[model samples]
Target: MATDLVRAFVREDLKKSDVVAEVVSLVTVLEQEDFRKLLQEFVDGIDQSMLLDVHLLNGLVQLIRNAPQGYIDVDDLVKILGLLNTRLKDTHKQSTRHTYQLALTISQVLDSMVDSQVKGLSREQLHEPLSDYLEELKQDQDPYLVYQATYAY
Candidate 1:
């Protein structure tokens, strides 16, 4: 049932982008085995490239960061983080506001994971892109961006 629902969401033109987060929410309170299968099905069914968009990637990252203990498997979580890293590679060209949003999202996710007992990407893995974001943020003249980066850094 979860697999079918996930597939349906992926097929829906308007809802496809929301699939990652919805799946995360659905499986949060489920058993580990169930969570693993649902997440594996989701990962296997979606095109990896679709996650390269920052909006979708943000949803996935935030979901993993905020989800409960059984919501996503380590392998799937790693794959999502990898996608985010790939998408964020050239983010320096984006506006400060955009960079700040991305950095803040990643930072909040990292912070949430610390507060939760859920397991997913290691701190080392998330910090790589964050470090880059902080470096980029350092060059921005906007005090808001600087403040956010400093707080997140």
Candidate 2:
């Protein structure tokens, strides 16, 4: 019941927020070691096959994108980068797109805090796991994602 847990977690009074402030609060939870176990539990609670769907992946990217600057702690980075590495290594095109969008958002953090990690990155140099995600977005079906690619330039 990974979906169930994700649903419960997402529906928690904790997950509902469009503003960056609320998102930062969520990121704080991710910074805690307990959050890793919770996330694995949440994923394990779901049907493994559902991992193929881009919706869940999309939601994850959205979550990271919504995080506030300087709040992306190492634990949070571990979760985000690990997922991106796994999805991209498998050559999941659409899944990679979601990651790219996440990078684009982070790169635009006004202060460019994520820039050194994300720019012109190779798969091996993915300090932030930047390859497949950025590549897919740079050449995406969505214009906004495309626009987002150049925004870094």
> Best by TM-score, which number?
1
Alpha-carbon lDDT of model 2:
0.45
Quote the lDDT for 113 in model 1: 45
The TM-score obtained by model 2 is: 0.40
lDDT (Cα atoms) of all candidates against the true structure: 0.56, 0.45
lDDT of 2 by residue, 36-114 (tens): 4444433332225334434344444444455445544544444445454454445555654654544443344322335
Tell me each candidate's TM-score. Answer: 0.56, 0.40
Question: What's the lDDT of the predicted structure labeled candidate 1?
Answer: 0.56
Query: Candidate 1 residues 4-86, lDDT tens each?
Result: 66556556555354565676666545555655555444444333444334445455454556556645545554464454454
Q: Any runs in candidate 2 off by more than 4 Å, and if so which?
A: 1-36, 42-50, 58-75, 89-125, 132-136, 148-153
Q: What's the residue-level lDDT of 134 in candidate 1?
A: 74
